[model samples]
Target: MDCNEYCELLPACADDELGAAESLRLEQHLAQCAACTAELGRLRALRAAVREGTTYHRASPALRARIAAALPAAAVPAAAVPAAAPASRPRWLEWFAWRPAANAGLAALTVASMAFGLTSFMLQDSPQDAMAREVVTSHVRALIADHAIDVVSTDRHTVKPWFNGRLEYAPPVHDMAAEGFPLVGGRLDYLNGQRVAVLVYRRNQHPIDVFVLRGAGSRKAAPDFDSTLTRQGYQITHWQAGGMDYWAVTDASAADLQRFSQAWRMASGGTP
Candidate 1:
């Protein structure tokens, strides 16, 4: 199968959810294609890291009790009333009986709880996923605007130093010319709620955007290759390595992107 086909099935392959025929086809392709092989390696490593890093915590008794208390009472206990009870109560008894102010307070608390849960889910990334999504979004935006970089240069030294005080950390920049991908330039962007440096590069006619940001938390033990196709036709691969989050996005074939990622891992002193 071609690279685009492979890219489409990669998430399934990584999750080992591919059907037999598809799995065989992908394996056969990997055997004959060095680039595909490299990509599979990166993806496998990323999946492992994500699995290892994911943590599940049970809610504390006190917290659970609070959540339960916030919910409207299901039914009033017999002990809460006299033997003789009113027969004209509304079908939706809880809503009808609740004080207006109490009902409003409960609605606000429910909304706040949902918002907190969503925010927590997004922040669960261990650098890799965060960086990858950032790069993907930036690339997609740049492609739509037809502007991918602020400063264009081939020299790593030139691009690296350009971010001097613009960012909190100096993003590691390298020229991969010998490997068929050349450094193009760099730009500044915001990702995961922080300002970041974006290093641009090219593989053949396609552009690859790499996002570099400060190590927000502890270093993840491996790369996280979260891939997704943008509405603008670019595929994004995001991960973390060497305590820095890196997200690379491009319209280049999946095999080419995988090759770039493998080369990047080697150049960065191995994944994680």
Candidate 2:
């Protein structure tokens, strides 16, 4: 199904109300569509937040005992009192009567939490914020999945050729081995609704992924196509070369990422 059709089923998918066949199709489409995948991620996160907010913790045994002790003596029958109760009749019966109301209060608190969390999350989701969130999530997923490199090689020739038919545009790959950001490998990734090349590199134990995609060339005739920013503690640098957009994301320092972007632009014969 197309994006619009898949989006229409997103709420159902989030609620697990879709049929098996339709769910399968949606999953297949999500594999290729980054936009839809990001949307699904948002939905799942929302559901998780709501679940977390609504979760209730039962009253502790100590608190229950204290409440029982504070009630009037005649309110509880002798059989209801525990061995530790005072000489007077314990009001365990009153405590039992109030238990349901306490539970109901907790339930109301959970609902309020869910509503507040949902509103807070929705308020922060501007287009730019969502894109940055997606970028950080993609970085985290790569680490968790342990599939950082699809074609592990230090050679640029080997890595660049791997994306020949997999993507519509050829991503320029460079071997920065001598420069300390060695080419570790490359992988095909979905970003911004298209399959792109993600060149992997490393500095010590830090891994950097450079996502490449087709972009409308620099908005001006001048070659001012380099920018850098940090999101979720990861440094990201964006530059355009040969009509393709490049974004390098890493835990490396800003200076290191900037150096890598400059080196990449030089290798691609683009302005720094």
Candidate 3:
């Protein structure tokens, strides 16, 4: 899908109102287009901000009673009215007549509630959430600046050793040209509070960035499985291989990313 088509359906996509097939197509477009991905992110963030910053409160029991009492007797249905009733207005209706202080209090509460909710959401972001945003921003910036790679070499020997004396840990580099993902080059990028290795690869013409960093270890015996996340339209597949955390970011389809991960594991002699 083109950017224009993607933009048209972005609201529905953000609201999860698209059909299965339409949603799939939209995601595919997002994976390959950096600008669209960034736009989607902005849309989602704006939606969240609006939702968090708005609030509606129903009237309290006392307030409800006051308003009900202020209504005119004629406002009630004939069948619901008592026979020979006094023709005075209901007490609740008095609120609208002259209770300025009570009306002002209700308005103030609404504004305060909205402000508090929005402020809390903005201030309560976790470290992991911040890291994910940083990772995505770095990936998008690299593409826009046309500085996706610093060193251009497909040789695993040359790429792996290029990180020498640059990072504390050694990042394994493998060529997966046979699997349709060819090593294109490598570069250095700072992310998640550390300088890391970014190995570049290409599946057809789309670039895939594989970021390598020191692993915090896996919850299981061996990090055999990979975790996938879709942000703004980019697919991020993370795995732990040889005590190094590998995060592969690309506009490639999830299936392609899975295959890339499997091929990488096999090439590195890591678990499937």
Query: What is the C-alpha local distance difference test score of each model?
Result: 0.69, 0.72, 0.74
lDDT of 3: 0.74
lDDT of 1: 0.69
For model 1, residues 181-235, the per-residue Cα lDDT tens digits are 9998988865555667888889989988887765663243235754443424667
Q: Which stretches of candidate 3 lie over 4 Å from their true place?
A: 1-115, 118-129, 216-227
Q: Candidate 2 on 88-187: residue-level lDDT in tens?
A: 5345655545554464555456656877677666555554445555666677677775767899999888998999888777888888877789998988
Q: Which candidate would rank higher by TM-score, 2 or 3?
A: 3
lDDT of 3 by residue, 64-175 (tens): 5565455432345567767888447867875455344554465557656887677667655454444455567778878876879988998889888888998888888988
Ranking by lDDT: 3, 2, 1
Model 2, stretches more than 4 Å misplaced?
Answer: 1-9, 12-36, 44-128, 216-227
TM-score of each predicted structure versus truth: 0.49, 0.58, 0.59
Q: RMSD, each candidate, Å?
A: 15.7, 11.8, 12.4
**Index of the highest-TM-score prediction:** 3
Give the clashing pairs for model 1: 132-238
lDDT of model 1, residue 167: 74
